[model samples]
Target chain A: MAELTYREALRRALDEELERDDRVFLMGEEIGRFEGSYKVTAGLWAKYGPKRVRETPISEEGFVGAGIGAAMLGLRPVVEIMTINFILVAQDMVVNHAAKIRYMFGGKVGVPMVIRTPGGAGAQLTAQHSQSLEVWFAHVPGLKVVAPSNPADAYGLLKSAIRDDDPVLFVENLVLYNVTGSVPEPEEDFTLPLGRAHVAREGTDLTIVAHSYTVRRALAVADRLAQSGFEAEVVDLRTLRPLDVDTVVESVRKTNRVLIAEEGWATYGVGAELAARIGRACFDDLDAPPERVAGAEVPMPYAKPLELAALALEDKVEAAARSLLAECGLVGSA
Target chain B: MARAVDEVHDVLQDGEQALRLLRLMLLIRRFEERAEEQYTRARIGGYLHLAIGEEAANVGSIDCLGPDDYLFTSYRDHAAALAVGSSPAAVMAELFGKVTGVARGYGGSMHLLDVDRRFLGGWGIVGGHLPIAVGAALALDYRDVAGAVLCQFGDGATNIGAFHEALNLAAVWSLPIVFQVINNLYGMGTSVEQSSAEPELYKRACAYRMHGERVDGNDLLAVREAAGRLLTRAREESRPALLETTTYRFRGHSVADAGKAYRTAEELASWRERDPIARYAGLLREHDLLDDGQLESMRKEVADEVSEAIREAAAAPAPDLGGLYENVYGDERWREQFERMDTAAPFGERMETRSWQS
Candidate 1:
């Protein structure tokens, strides 16, 4: 087994893929000499040279669209946006061209490109930088959206995202870079399938479904509940687009109670979609109505406490889980 | 590289090439005329943008492109497609949204494409495709591919942010591409003078320190000359350039636009006087390259071909409805992934409905 930080996992995936395939290259602002805004692409730029580790100007629409065009011409381009919030500038290209090219062209060509971007609010980066827009890309049909919570999944899913034939939005968490976990050994042939959910902690009392950073919060809440003789199941939804509803329904069937945690607004969010599907599939099995724990519905403020309250934190996940368990009449005895 | 003025003289001396340019321009004119008629007859739906008066700008620049070059354009693309050798019948069939059309009728008038020919697409967004076109040029540079890209758009696209970004990147990267602006006087209804602070669009290329020039788009031989030279420079030296072809649309922006609201009849008549087709014909006659009989025969041949295109397009069948789910995803695994979302009952209710059974 090999241990790696979330940021290291992402870097390893990029390094391995660039070495494995010559067609794979990178394009983004400050990604080469600047070593990325997040420093995830630190040494790879020095190793790959200018052609492979291509640097771009602060023109999101220009560079993102260029990536799509290169992909159409049979090259695998991994485009990195500084953050998901800045991706709005290139939304027209991402939504209209990258996602719709293959379908609009009647399947004549596919845009095999990966857009690696990070989202989530915790770093007091103000309203503009602090935002979660995974649902925006996941809402689209042609793009595949994947957000891995752990270091291992981050490494495996990114490798798969680069190899995927269609355009993939590889969403990452801004705060999970320092977190570490054991990845498979380099000698072991390991690659996680997209659209699959992982059961991080198995329990019988309740099911807490989440994705990205929220999964880590939910797992911690599960561990806390276990101390009080309450068993809580945590399902980390690794992929959002080709959502694994079957695995979620199976978890809901066993637990008979459901709670969804998301870092975005509650209305029309990824949690909303998951709750809708779980409500429909496990209606007869659910001991109580599906519940959600999400961030405050306003634009993230700059204040430290306000930002903390506005973000999806561990305390929020615990309260939501406890309330759902109480409603299902399975209150744990401390 | 061939100088712009020298190529004009060369085109004049070569009677065979001059006649071919005249024939293609006539074919595009005839095709657009028939396409407008079909739109009125309800054979074609969606927006129908015509390039009736801008024949030289469309035909001349595209004439310089070789089999190795890639071409991209804005929505007013029927003329460019025809100039690039897509059959008139297939183009018309696409407008009809028939199964046999290019893009399989999926992309109608605004989104025509022929990937095999390297005419990437006719993008619908105003300035949306410029950066994408730049990226294609970057790919060519990266692979050291011996080719260049021609990105054609209307004057309206110049005001957009993507346009500026694309030019800046193309200059910085030294991508092998030419950004051809077909200044048709009006971006839909707003004139260039009213819209741009510096209405001389070619001069804007100087901001990126790239080569830029303006040619009288109505002059067929001149447009062909400048475009050929610039394209050669791009492929040989990997230098990006901007070529502005100042032309005009004879009709309104689309078929629905009357085109009379903003401009007077006198202005319309003035542009018509400089009709690219008639002007080219006059020049060809002056050079003893074309006679009245030959011009008449050319017109008759174009009219016949356009008529046959309409007939074939109208007869072609529509794409099957069962394939509604097709082309959405390239990977075969998507089928199994989407299968779980499928339920015979509405609202995800798997229970069998007894009302129909009863």
Candidate 2:
């Protein structure tokens, strides 16, 4: 295994895919020359040159539609939306065109494309920029939505998403970019499948299921639980659309309690979906009523303290997990 | 379909070409007449847009497109699909929502596609297909191929954001595409004069500094010549252009609309005098290229063809109900992704089904 940051892992995935297949190309605003607003595409423009690593004008609807068009004509385009907020402008192309093309076209051809964008809050970027809109895409049919927590998953899932036969929305977390982890060494052709949940931590006292940046927070919360002699198994929901209920349910069955966490608002959020699914899967027979820890339901505030409070912080996750264990009458017993 | 203009020069200059063009237009007119009847009979469902009076605009532009060209059109695409050589029976089957239809009854009248002919789609949204057409051009350019894309939409699509975005991208990238606007005056209920600030659709190309032209859509040779030349320029110069074909639709926005709501009887009568099919037939007659007997026989032939299409489509079975969940995902991994939705036994045993079925 080799150590790499989440950003580096994503970059390597792009570089490898572009080098491996000529049909694979990148298109987005400032992706070339400027190297992307987040610098995720740094050095790709120089490495692949202009045609493959294209720099698009700030026309998300145009370029995203272009990506869909190109994918229709047998080219695999990995389009960057800069951030999730910008994708709303191109919602028609993504939801109506991209998501509906495969089914509406009667299975004749499908878009083998990937739309990679980051979504997260905490930088005090305020309401518009800080929102997590992954659930909006996940709710759609005919589209694959994946959000990897670590560098290994970032590398593996991005590669798999690019190579997939349908349109895949590869969501990244803004805060998870600099987080480092050891991805398997190259040349092994190591790649993870989409829609498989990974057990980031194996424990039995309680199960904390989360994804993207929330996975990191859940892990930190699990560590805090360990200090209290409790073990919280953390299930990283790598793929939201094809959520791995098998893994989540199996973990919950062992722990008898679950606490779902997310960086988005609790209502109609990932936490909400998972909690509902878990309750349905287990028939609401859990130790507690499947608790949840989510970011504040209001629009994210710009102030630092307000931003921290609005986020699903580690303490908030720990508190939720502790309450669930306490309700199960196992808090002090642990 | 990618043959050079000179390759078709002899045909266009002779009576054989006149017969070919007239036959296709008559076929479109006949097919649409049958489709309207089918809609009335309740055989066809969903939105049904027809291109009756704009036959010349559809056929002329579509005929110029060779094998190396890709085609996209607005929902008023029955004529466009027929012009691209999609089997009349298959087009009718698609309209009839039969399993044998072009899109297998999934995408009925508004979303016909002939992947083999490279007729990408008949998009339901007014301006949505423009960017997709531009992207197809971008694909051709990326492949360094000698091909171009022909995107057709009505005057109503001009005001949408996607239209401007598509045009700007095509111009900035110098991609190979021809944006043809069939200016039939109205975008549903709203007229072009009501919707666009600049009613001159072709002049909007000047904003991108691209070549723009307008042609008499009712005149077969005018549209054919303009589209053919522009498509050739795109393939050779790696440039994009805008061509506006002025025509009028006899039907309303869809078959549901009577078209009398916004148009005057006098205006309709005036446009009927300039009907594309009639104008072409008159021109052919003036040149002694088409006689009344030939026109009658051609009409009879087209009528039989469309009648056969209708017979087959009506007889064809509806798509299987089991196929409802198919094609939403084009991958083996969909089973894993979809297992969570299955409440029974959770993820007992999953199986991967078809992938795009292509």
Candidate 3:
């Protein structure tokens, strides 16, 4: 294993996949010469040349549909939308065509396309660019949504998504790119199965469920709670659509109290979906109602303090976890 | 993989090929009539858009395509499927929502595809398929292959954002594709003149500096000529072109529309006078290629074929309900992937549930 940043891990995965498969190619705006807005595709265009690492005009709907078409015709296309917000312009292509093509066409053709885009806040990108809209695609049946919270998962999950036969939405986080961790070496071909939740930390008293960048926040909260003598189990949901509720329920049943967290709004968000499912599954084992902490339900502000307030950070999560533990009569040291 | 492609000039001179073209158009006409009857009889359901009055526009351009060429069309796709060599029984069975249909009853009348024939889809959305067709051309260019893509849509699709994006990409990249707009006068209920600032749709290609032209859609040879020319250039030179086939639909956009609300009877009568099949048959007769009683026999033959197709479709069984989740995802592990997602009994719901809340 070698240490790499989350951005480096993703770039390494793309490089390896490009070398591994001739059908795999990249398409997106500013991905080629400009190297990408966030620089995730830096050096890829020069390495792969213009054909394999194509740069498109600011035509999300065009290129995304083009990616679908290419995937339909047996080529693997990895389209990069500069950010999750830009994907809105191509929402119809994803929701209607990419997601529905296989079933709608009666299994005649499948789109093996991967749409990669970064989502998250904290650099003052404001409301539009800072949204976590992965749940919107997750709510659809055909799509497979994967969000990696660290460098290792960023490496493994992207490799799996590139090779998967269906349309996989690979969600990256802008803030996590510079974060470094150990990832498998190039010759290992290390890959992770999608739709499985990883229990990042094992604890007994409370369960905190989260995904993507929120998982990092949850883990930090778990660490803070450990200092207070409350061991909170952190269940990082790697895949959102084919959600590994079995793992979450397993954790919830053991802990008896659960808190779901996200960077997106709580209403109809990933947290809401998990809360409903957990309520039904762990109804017998519950110590308290499933609680949730989400980003403030407002357009993210430009001011630093307001942005910090808008996000569901570790402090808020720790407070919510402590409150749930207190209700369970398991209060710990301050 | 390079093979000789026939131009419209050569095919137009061949009498036997001309007769086959006439027959294909007749077959589509007969198939649609039965489909309309089937819809009213409650045998077929959903939005059924027929190419009844625009047969030449559908068959003539599609006939220009080689076997290796890919096809993508909007909702008005019955004739496209038939013209692409999909069997009458299979097409009819699809209309009947039977298991044996081209798309196995899943893609009703609006969505039909014969993938082996390289016909990608008969998509239901208006402007959605254009970019997909352009992508197919991008694939061909990427693979450095010999085939091209032909995307057919209505006059309505020209106004959508995807239309502009698709054309711009095809032109910018010099992808091999022919975008055919079968302008049947009205986009459902509205006229092109009322909807578009520039009523002449072909000129829209100028925005991308792409080659564009218009043809008399009711004239069979005219459509064949333009499609043939553009498709050849697409295949040989890797160029993109827009061909507008100006025609009229005798029936409404869908069977639900009475068609009388939007247009005048005088206009309909005038178009009926220039009916493609009748026009072609007269032309063939004048050239001494068609003889007395030949047209009647061809009509009789096609009518019988369509009737047989209808019977076969009617007798065919509907798809099994148990197989509803078959094609949603293509991964081999999709069953396992979705098994966990089965929300009915999330882990402990069925395991001796703790009262109603469980």
Q: Report the lDDT tens digits of candidate 2 across residue range B1-358.
A: 6546665454446888779999999999999998999999999999898898999999988998877789999888889889989999999999998999999999999899999999999998779989999999999999998899999999988899999999999999999999999999999889999889999999999999999999999999888888888999999999999999999999898989999989999999999999999888998888889899999999999999999999999899999877887899987777766676554222322233333343
DockQ of each: 0.61, 0.69, 0.76
- Taking the tens digit of each residue's C-alpha lDDT, what string does model 1 give over B167-221? 9999999999999999998999999999999899999999999999999999998
- What's the lDDT for all of these models? 0.89, 0.90, 0.91
Q: How many angstroms is residue B237 displaced in model 1 relative to the true structure, after the best TM-score fit?
A: 0.5
lDDT of 1 at B219: 96
TM-score of chain A of 3: 0.99
Could you report the Cα RMSD, in angstroms, for every candidate shown? Answer: 2.6, 2.8, 2.7
Model 1 chain B poorest 10 in a row by lDDT:
B342-351
TM-score of chain A of 1: 0.98
Could you tell me the TM-score of chain B in model 1? 0.94
Chain B TM-score, one value per candidate, order as shown: 0.94, 0.94, 0.94
TM-score to native of every candidate shown = 0.96, 0.97, 0.97
Give each model's clash number: 0, 4, 0
lDDT of 2 at B149: 96
**Stretches > 4 Å off in candidate 1:** B1-9, B337-358
1 or 3: which has the higher TM-score? 3
Off by over 4 Å in 2: B3-12, B340-358
Prediction 1 TM-score vs. true: 0.96
Q: What is the interface RMSD of each candidate, in Å?
A: 2.1, 1.8, 1.2
Q: On residues B1-358, what C-alpha lDDT tens digit does candidate 3 reach at each position?
A: 1223454766557889889989999999999998999999999998889899899999888887886689999989999999999999999999999999999999999889999888888887789999999999999999999789999999999999999999999999999999999999899999999999998999999999999999999999888878888888899999999999999999998999989999999999999998999998888898878875888899999999999999999999999866676898999988776656554353343334324342
